[model samples]
Target: METGAVDEASIDSLTDFYLGCGVDGMTILGIMGEANKLTGEEARAVASRILKRVDGRVPVVVGVSSPGLDNLSSLARFAMDEGAAGVMVAPTPGPAVEDRVRGYFHQVCEALGPDVPICLQDYPQTTGVPISVETILTLTRDCPQIVMLKHEDAPGLRKVSAVRNRSGTSETPRLSILCGNGGLYLPQELARGADGAMTGFAYPEMLVEVVATHQAGDVERAEDVFDAYLPILRYEQQPGYGLAVRKAVLKHRGAIACAATRAPGPRLDATDEAELMRLIARTEDKVKELSHGS
Candidate 1:
């Protein structure tokens, strides 16, 4: 940000870079995009800017999660109005009992009305709201608006199986399962019947490649390619420090001008920076070798 303002040029360039990476769709205002830091107005404005730049080039899902339902509704409405493909809603944290979890989403569905498509953000590790497989099934079954699931629960392969098994054969429509948690277990998730990945990995090209290669019926080759990028991908998943590494890599790749993390965000130290450079170089070499072999 120049003088604490949203940098439209940087965002435009980043959006272009994201498209260049051959991503099927984009999800703005998610955890990796620092949606939580922005106020409701700022979030909507940024969403508008991103959507305008995207201009229907690819499907964009905006995260409209807020503590207040009113703020969430307004952002969702604003985003959809600005041409967002869908909106992602993460449940509020704390001991949100199963029924309340279901009820909260029910209220959200009612508030947003029927036109908007909803992607349930089920990152229990972050949201502190552990929605059971049954609750998720019920939500998808009962709520026709909730069309997608951002499945991020660790050891969630069974949950994916349950959703896929029930929803595919039952009267309910299909629920698109896009696995997250930094794409750490993507191969397994895909095997467990996830439709695709929806994580914010620094190297989305690798994520896209792995999913595409797997979808092409070449699982072994996909893992081989994923292994080439694992060092950098794993390095970029360091809990609180991941976003810093992501922006730093993007800056290094010339996709963004600044690696500066927004306020109250993590920045890499000199040691971290040096290690990231090494990983980038090594990943490039491995990818080149794989391409030659192929």
Candidate 2:
């Protein structure tokens, strides 16, 4: 953000850029979007701008995660009014007990009402809430509104298998399993039955190609394609400094005009930039090599 405010024009440009990248949908105000940094009004404005710019070209899910249910529900309704396809809600960090965590989501669905389709975010690393497989199943059973799970739990391949195994059954209804954590475990997660990836990345086209290649019965080719970008992908997923790297790449690729994040965010030094550029060059070479060999 320039001058500590949301850049509406950048949001519009990025929305169009993502559409060109062949993304299936757009999710705004998510964890990677600095949702916590934006004030309520700023967040709503960003969502509205992106939704209007998209104009139903693809599904747009606005993240409405809030500590208070009233605020959460309020923004959710606003997004729905603005033509959002769905709303994403992550359980607030608190007691990690099963009943409390499960009950919290139940209340969330109730607050969201029946019409809003839910994409449950399960990022225990950020939310401090551990959700078991059974708890997730119970939630889907109890709340038909939860149609997607943003599975980001580390070592979550087993969890993906568990969820997909159940969802494939006759008794359990299906839920879209979109893997996140910046697509760090994407190759393995896809092998474990994940439906797709919904995470931040500099080269979203790489993600689209990976998912497409995997689904076309070319699993090994998918892994090879993913390996070409693994270095940059891993570099961009760094816990504290990742977003800065991501923005820099977006700017470098002409998606956004500037790499400047909001105030109080990271800025890359010369050494960091040199390393990032080297990785980008290497990834480009690797991708070219893979294409030639194919």
Predicted model with the maximum lDDT: 2
Candidate 2 residue lDDT tens string, 1-294: 567677777787888899999999878888885788999998889888889999999999999999999999999999999999999999888888999988898999888899999999999999888899998888888899999999999978999999999884666688899989988888899998999999989999889999999999899999999999999999999988998999999988888888887878988999999999898899899999999999
Total clashes in model 2, counting residue pairs 3 or more apart in sequence or in different chains = 0
CA-lDDT, candidates in order: 0.88, 0.90
lDDT of 1 by residue, 1-294 (tens): 624466778889999998899999999999766777777777878889989998998999999898899988988998998999989999988676998899999999999999999999998888888889888888988999999999998778889998888885557778999989888888888888898989887678988999999999999998998889888888888888888899899989988888877788788899999989999999999999999999
How badly does each model clash, as a count of residue pairs? 0, 0
Q: Which candidate should be chosen as best, given TM-score against the real structure?
A: 2
Which runs of model 1 end up more than 4 angstroms from their true locations? 2-4
**Candidate 2's C-alpha lDDT?**
0.90
TM-scores of all predicted structures: 0.97, 0.98
TM-score of predicted structure 2: 0.98
lDDT of 1 at 217: 97
